[model samples]
Target: MPIRMHDTLRRKKVDFSTIEAGKVSMYVCGVTVYDRCHLGHARCYLSFDLIHRWLEQSGFDVHYVQNFTDIDDKIIHRANELDGDWKKLVDENIETYYEDMDALNILRADDYPRCTDYVDDMIRITADLIEKGNAYVADDGVYFSIESAPEKYGMLTGQILENVRSGAGGRVDDTGKSKRDHKDFALWKAAKPGEPTWDSPWGAGRPGWHIECTAMSMDYFGAQFDIHGGGHDLRFPHHEAEIFQGECHTGCSPVVHHWLHNGFVNLDGEKMSKSLGNFWTINEILKKVDAMVLRFALINAHYRSPIDMNDALLNDAERNYNRVLECYVTSLKGCLAENNVPLPVADFASTNPLSKSLALLEKMGEGFAKAMDDDFNSREAVAKVLGAVREIMKMHNSDMDAVDSNAFSHYAIDWLEETAGAVLGVLPTREMALAEPEEDPRKLEIADEVDALLLARTQARSDKDWAKADEIRDALHQMGVVVTDTAEGPTWDLA
Candidate 1:
């Protein structure tokens, strides 16, 4: 099936038809360089990373852009607390964010524009809004005129005027600006003493959080783009505000074609928040599980479903990840031992059981595509990959004597490695997956005893004591040595 994703704007499914043919422009909200990225950040970024990979593999040339709000309030606070230069602090955290993301195998976006770098663009937009009479300067800051775009002010958030009006009375400071309503928000924050600021037409000030994305995304992807994605929590004030302000300035009906939001991260059924003290940093969790394992765990759930960050769930994720790795390793071992085997021809003109397996793989790909297209459902897509693993495992256990080695050849191995490597990004080498000098004391001791048992068993086979031979095979299996009969006699390996 061709890719069709869920459009959050219309709240229905839609295909990825680009405004321009054969190319896609995507913008995702990037991290604010204030602290180390945590599990919540991991879940959001990885979800989008998978979406980007799928789009590329499905034949779309994607130009992905993300922004870094380096000059935000959090960065300023942290810098002052540490007695460090503010820009230096942003630079350090940006570097650290890249490091953690690289370890997780997320591809670099086409552009990572920083808010500090786009000050001129912001100033120009602010000037345009002012010229259009949609904004005014206040003693403390410049605020966008909500009354200017009254027709579509609360369209994105689905709130009525009374609710917006009621909510605003609590937050609005009526003493400052000559505002018609409390729903109006900041466009440019006035420069305070010792905060990062640039000289603008109104005064020295910085762009608001919502204005940064609006300016940066339009600067990169034009007035509108194919898709806009971020965490679900951002939908309310962040994204809704972005759309309202963006449309007001550009006089456009909608700022984006499709909006995608991945589900939230949870800890023991509660939202993972800094105040809850249940939140864990991505680097800190990396110390516990391999980065790939953590990625797998996050992908194990549908991107639209809430994920719980805990030890038990992660343990299961690790086991599932090992199973996928084991499939790759087992195939590698067979391919190495049977080097004379002919390569597979990727055609299926004749009807056969192998064709059924191939058909299953094709169906799996379709299922994954559908799920991913529907709001980037990575968990469901990964489950489809696991389903392919099941079929490959079945084929691996089938007898080779009944089939020609030249026919099946490396078909199963190639299929598993190619799809898994490209999609899930798990490809383990033989040395890393299986072969190594036994460092676990228990494995070494067991291997020694198994070798002694094998010697007696070999003698028994020579003496025609079939019962004794079978007994030793079972015994070795109980000790974790997987035994199999070969033309060269019985071969065994530590499980």
Candidate 2:
């Protein structure tokens, strides 16, 4: 199946088609760079990262661009509150952003255009808007005239232009003092006292919040691009303004072919916010849980679905993650056994248990791909992965005497580690996922006891004493040990 995604503009799922064949130009709206990234940020970026990985896997060469609003009211205010320079504050947070995202294993964008770096480009676009009569220069700044393009002004948000007003959050100070229309958003802001200023035709002032994205995206991907995405909060004024300014300046009909927005990260049934005191920063969460566990938790749900952040969610993710890891480690150990035999290819057509198991493992990759292709539905794709693991475990435990365990292990391990791991961006390496926990002397003593029980169980089974074998297995279970009897030996793990 071809890739199908929900476009926020159209508000429906549509088949995705890039402007350029076999290539995708994607621009995801980035952070403001004034504070540490939180779980909401992780949700947004990881959703796009999933898309990026899937695109690459689907044979599309994706050129992704994400920008940073290094200069903003938030940054300036945060700097004042911290008694630090605005640039220094942005720099610190940008570095921390990288560290946090890298920890989550989000793929880096091809270009990260800072707002301050593209002041010249912003000024040029602002000037062009004025020359085209799409924007007007006010006493304080340049504002994009919403009246200039009435039909396309509110197309993105599906709001009537007449009822739209400025100052709807993330809007520039469009106080009705000098603007023509209340809906007219700021393209450029005039210089303020003691604030970062850039040289422009209007005066030494900085670019507006929405204009920076238009400038940077156009600079990187030209007038039109394949996909523009951000959090659902941006669907309104921030992205709406991008569509207005981009099309008006470039004289293009559609600025971006598809608009993707990931849903919010809710905390305990409420939206996460700093003021509400429900916000959990990525760094803070990482200190408690494994990074891959967090990534798995975030991706376990559909990207467009709101994920509830809580201890329960993390715990569930850790449990599921351990199940996958256990299967992978078991497969690796079985494959590395010296006396294991390979299943014959000629026997594949026969009704042999090993051949049936191998056939199931081979089809898992296609199942994974099919799930991803349907709107990048990661939740379903992850289900397929876990389903494959369950099948592998059933074969290992129930069909061990009839199947070639080594052959099944080789195929399952490669598919889980290479194919599924590549797009999921988790469980890539064995050491990371399956590393042994630090040995405790007390636990070591328990391990010796568990081994002795397993040895007795094996001997009982070999001596045809079924009742004794069952008794030993019951003792191991009571001691919190889960033992699976195989043809080679009994594999034990802590319950």
Candidate 3:
């Protein structure tokens, strides 16, 4: 089936076709870079990352661009509070942003255009908007004249102009500022004392929050691009302003072919808020949970659905992720043991557990693709992954002796790794996840102790000492080890 995605502008899912054949130019609004990224940021970026991964997997050459709002009110205020240079603060946070994102395994964008680096381009676009009579220079700064392009102005938000209030119901504030209309937002802000300022035709000032994205996106993807995305909160004045300024300058009808917005991250039934002290930064969360587990938790929900962050949700995610990982590891071990042995091709077509398992694996792959193709529904895709892993595990345990050398088993292993590991990025490669590192003496001693306890527990069970076995299991659980008994044997993993 052809790929379809929900376009916020159209308010419906539509067939997705790139502007250029077999190629996609996508621009997602990135971080403000004033502070650490939070769960909301993770949700937005990870959603796009999944989209990027699937597009590439589907044979589309995707040029993904994400921009940084390096210079902003928050950055300036924080810099002043720290008694440090704004650039230094931004630079430090930018590095931390990379560190956090890298930990999450999000693919790096093709281009990361910082706002400060494109002041000249922003000035040119602002000047062009003024010349086109779509914007006007005020005593304070340049503002996009909403009334100038009335026909195109609220198309993205579907708001009727006359009925629209001056402040757009607190979505934007026009108070105490020079503007032809209250709905008109800033294109440039005249620099205040001690604020970072750049030389511009509008006097020494910086680009407004909305103008930076338009300027930077146009610089990379031209006046028109395949898709533009950000958090759902940006669907209002921020994105709407981009549409107004971009079209007014380029004389185009739609600035982008599609507009995608991921839903917000909610905490305790409310929007995650820094002021409420309910928000958790990616770094803060990573310190407590593994990065892969957090990534799975973030992607387990549909990108358009608000994910509620809480201990229970994360715990469930951790357990589900461990199941997937253990299955993959088991398959990996089997493939290594049966190296270079190929199953009879005829057996794969026969009606047996091996062939049935292959069929299920194929069906799972189809489901994964179908879910992803339909608006990049990662939540459904992940379900399909778990289903495939479950079926693969059953076949591994039940039919290993019958089809130990079957090529289908190897094929299944490779398919699982690619779909779950490469496409979803939830599973790391064996080299990365299982490679032995230089061990600390204390950790080695702990491992030895755990191994000895596991052996004793196995013997106790064999001797029918259920009480002793349960006691050892409880002790191991206290030490952060989880034990599961399978038909083959008992297996243990970290909690």
Candidate 4:
């Protein structure tokens, strides 16, 4: 119940104590702009959004930054395949990324530093690394010497220096790449024919994948910050390389105070990827279900736990999402409809509520904070929120008025709205979902009108006035209702 989180460093849970008290700086590895955003991407961003929300809700002033890899090998390759402009491809995909995330209610990062925008800073850092003897120029470009950094190579990734495998297709020429060890990665790559390039310390070239984060994060949040996060897949080469570069430039060992990574998203128990051909783009999935349900499905399991997304699981998550939203709306309706409403208060409880539903809200709120503090266990924190929602529904069904007065119903609703809505960037209103497909109330109203008209038409038919009966039928049809005659008489419905 106390504010604690599992520190991936120590490999166990510990009480969260920030490097600097009362302030938090967090950065997340953002998208590479070559392709459409997918559900797996949503899982990463949404998970971080919840962590950012909980941190801010817990009274920490969080300056969150996420970067975009706007210029990369994939972006260039994709552009060439389509005979498209490289910058245009990056620009279009970046815009699409924002559109997809906005649809899912993801909080835009305080700073979205694109790799292209920070090329100058990256050059500066590369120059610094070269001057400091941490990087060397290869025939193709500049490479970071793994042997020059302060910590042991592969300290963060736990990869053995000798046995590491480099990624395929883009290996620097072995001649000029004076890596003390073979595992040393690139800092900059010399521009190839038909590739996007910028002028850098080692001639006209682009920043390497890992160097981009190092330069951008240090430029924004200082050489060292409170937290750094990305996918579990990135912990090895990407993040480990980031740490090495940051330390080489800043003369600091741990440029990040804490490291966090969310687990993989599996599609039907297999990793979802382009190769698998089972990747569900966010837009593609949005067409099938609401964004909140997709978000709920991602967070239901622990952040570090793998999830195999299936139709039944998604339906279950949708039901849960609807139930939570319904309870929140119903509670607000009751609170607004109550007497002697409690004034908004600022006191926060650090213990779990055991006695009543209102106390449960306080308890769950505390649990949310504690869970987040413990290393940003957003999965556990969200459980507290869902639990509070469940308790509210139970009380609402049993005794609405008594529950309103006896509990901090007003305050709890406000808290949920603020923390869940503003902070966590989840649902701000029940209206997020479009009109229900089942019998709409307006349709029902029209149906009633149609029935009345049909009754009048039946009477007119019974009176032997075919002209009057036809006139009534035409009038009802004009009102967007269709009437059909049956053996029993007439039945009508809204169109």
Question: Which residue pairs clash within candidate 4?
Answer: 3-370, 4-374, 5-374, 5-375, 352-363, 353-363
User: Would you estimate the TM-scores of all the predictions?
Assistant: 0.83, 0.86, 0.90, 0.80
Whole-model lDDT per candidate: 0.78, 0.86, 0.86, 0.77
Worst ten-residue run, lDDT, model 2? 167-176
C-alpha RMSD by candidate, in order: 5.5, 5.3, 3.2, 7.5
Best by TM-score: 3
Worst 10 residues of 4 by lDDT: 346-355
Candidate 1, residues 138-217, lDDT tens digits: the string is 77677777777777655555767667544444443233354455677777888878887888887887887788998899
Q: Report the lDDT tens digits of candidate 4 across residue range 309-329.
A: 999889998887777677667
Q: Please tell me which model should have the higher lDDT, number 1 or number 3.
A: 3
Backbone clashes for every candidate come to 1, 0, 2, 6
The order of the candidates by TM-score, greatest first, is 3, 2, 1, 4
What is model 4's C-alpha RMSD?
7.5
Give the C-alpha miss distance for residue 136 in model 3, angstroms: 1.0
TM-score-better candidate, 1 vs 3: 3
**Candidate 3 lDDT, tens digit per residue, 1-495?**
899999999999999988889999999999998899998998999999999999999999999999989988888878989966988888899999999999999999999989889999989999999998988899989988877878876677788887776553444333226777788888899988877789998799888988999989998889899999999999887899899988999988787999999998889788789788898999999999999999999999999988888888899999999999888777766665564665533334577666566776778888999999999998899999999888877877774573463455577668877788888898887776566556656556678788899899999999999999999999999987788999887877675
TM-score: model 4 vs. ground truth: 0.80
Query: How much is the lDDT of residue 427 in candidate 1?
Result: 57
